[model samples]
Target: MGYHFKFEKIMSVKEREKNEALSAYNDSVKRFEEVAEKLYELLKKKEDLESYQSMKLVSGLPVLEIRHHQQFIVNLQKSIEQYQKMVQNARNHMLFQQEKLMHKNIEVKKFVKMKEKGLHEFLEEVKHVEAKQMDDISIQHFVHRGS
Candidate 1:
């Protein structure tokens, strides 16, 4: 049987942790992108409304209606501010997730390195034993021939 890696169980656990961390990071990124897209749309709408608000009023438009538009624009601005905050929060969350993923990655890599080192040492030991056995067999053959 092949040499069993001593740290195999630990390595597997670390790998699973890394996978979970990656999934969480991806989710965080997706959520951040969604919030950012919404913020962009809100900003675009605010810009369009502000431009429309700047237009000269003709006799066709009622004064009450114009004031309502102005009030609506103010409310929209407040909504935009709130969305901006949400976007920022999402970005922060994404950063936190990224950090967690990085930590997991590091842990997995450490275990992988340990396993590799262990395997290399095992192979070297096996090689040495094989060479020693070969030497002993050749010496025995020579002794039998001499007899």
Candidate 2:
């Protein structure tokens, strides 16, 4: 009576999987961006600190103040190193998610193609059946007119 794809359920499942994969990819990208931003900020702060330290040196700041600046710069470098690692890990995770999403998209596309092909075949069959019915009706009318 109606066109029904045998793999409709499978297609729906694949589509759902694709959506989940897409969401995961988006989340991973967000995480990567956040970590990268933090790393960038840390680097910028370190540069600014170094510039300030140089200015202080030119201004003849005290030895103790120079040591304090050096200590703070060291701590900033450690933090920057940690953030760099975090950013790398996040980027790797994002790439992994992207690959998974690509696979899911391909799967969904395959199922969609199958559904389209099935629908096309079903429509063709319907057209053939309708043409046969029309031919039968025409034959019946012709015979009645002959009688």
Candidate topping lDDT: 2
Which residue pairs come into collision in candidate 2? none
Worst 10 residues of 2 by lDDT: 52-61
| RMSD from true fold, candidate 2 | 0.8
Q: What is the TM-score of each candidate against the true structure?
A: 0.91, 0.97
Which regions of candidate 1 deviate over 4 angstroms? 56-62
User: What range of 10 consecutive residues in model 1 has the weakest lDDT sum?
Assistant: 52-61
What does the lDDT come to for candidate 1? 0.88
CA error at residue 57 for candidate 2, angstroms: 1.1
lDDT of 1 by residue, 33-144 (tens): 9998988888898888767766646335678978998888898889889988998999999999999999999998888788888889999999999999999999999999
Over 4 Å off, model 2:
none
Score residue 133 of candidate 2 by CA lDDT.
100
Q: Candidate 2's residue-wise lDDT over 1-147, tens digit each? A: 998889889989999999999999999999999999999999999999999989888979998998999999999999999999999999999999999999999998998888899999999999999999999999999999999
lDDT (CA) per prediction: 0.88, 0.93
